[model samples]
Target: MTAAHCTFFGESNPETVQSMQGCMRKLKLMVPKLRVQKRVKELEFIQHVIEYIRDLELILSEDESYTPHSTQISPISPHLDSTYRP
Candidate 1:
């Protein structure tokens, strides 16, 4: 069956069944890469949380080894704004 939805450059150029199958195949191949990227982001977030907890533990223990850098800023935090000063 022809793909009625597949078109190019505002043209109604009908895609053959082969072309549609190829598109699906390409999308399937890309799925792994997308999944890997998502997993990496998840791992990074977990690691960040672990490190934060470790820092908090050190501070609570009064080890003086967990000094938070004043210049450090969280790029992932949405709570920060242009007018907001710490």
Candidate 2:
């Protein structure tokens, strides 16, 4: 059997480039055999991991004692409250 070869056009060593090309060829040939359901599950797991990382980042960035100015309003006057009464 004739040996297969691939050419690389960069500063890479010939042996390393040849091995990488061979592995890429094998991966291309095998990709069509991968299941769609398995791919979806893998993507879902990746998405969940990304979301968990974002949530943790938000939690870590927040101050435990931080309070919003909106929640610090003074009590409304009783006369102002009666104006909107049904």
Best model per TM-score: 2
Displacement of residue 68 (Cα, Å) in model 1 is: 22
Least accurate stretch of 10 residues (summed lDDT) in model 2?
28-37
lDDT values for all models: 0.42, 0.44
Reference-based TM-score, model 2: 0.28
As a TM-score, model 1 comes out at: 0.27
List, residue by residue over 1-86, the lDDT tens digit for candidate 1.
Answer: 23443433444334655565465454333333332243345455445445545544544367454345546553423322221221
Error of 2 at 16 (Å): 19
- Model 2 has an lDDT value of 0.44
- Models 1 onward score TM values of 0.27, 0.28
Clashes of each: 0, 0
lDDT of 2 by residue, 60-85 (tens): 35747544544765543343322321
